[model samples]
Target: MHNLTSDLALALEVADAADAVSLAGFNARSFTVERKADKSEVTEIDRATETA
Candidate 1:
């Protein structure tokens, strides 16, 4: 149906936007890994990607 096609297109657009934001942040980060007190690895890229 036309409505179904429209919905799919909108979903695809949103996915594309998210990917752009995530990848942009990923590319801007250093690869240095830092460990937290919780023994978890955290990077600026991770937070940026999640926010994206």
Candidate 2:
């Protein structure tokens, strides 16, 4: 039970970090863009969000 609690806390921390990265990118006006293999739009924000 203690281990599960610790793991959940860690996951929440990671989520918060990711949210920060995503929000910053969302607010930024400029970022790179490219097409993925599936022909979908991709951008620098996308990469940063994934990394986070």
Candidate 3:
């Protein structure tokens, strides 16, 4: 019983939540960046966004 409209709305809500956490970190300049073993750079905001 999947509904297209509702699914899209849910997706948008998730995006908004992630954005909020991301922007908060950016605005406060409190995020940390780390290099993974793969040599890719990621930030605390990145991890928090995924957790959101």
TM-score per prediction, in order, is 0.52, 0.71, 0.87
Name the best candidate (by lDDT): 3
lDDT of each: 0.73, 0.85, 0.94
Ranking by lDDT: 3, 2, 1
Q: Write the per-residue lDDT of candidate 3 for residues 1-52, one digit (tens) a residue.
A: 7799999999999999999999999999977789989999999899999999
Q: TM-score of predicted model 1?
A: 0.52
| 40: Cα error in model 3, Å | 0.5
Runs in model 2 with CA error above 4 Å? none
lDDT string, candidate 2, 16-47, tens digits: 98899878887886777899999999988878
For every model shown, the clashing-pair count is: 0, 0, 0
Candidate 2, which ten residues in sequence have the lowest lDDT sum? 22-31
What would you estimate as the lDDT of candidate 3?
0.94
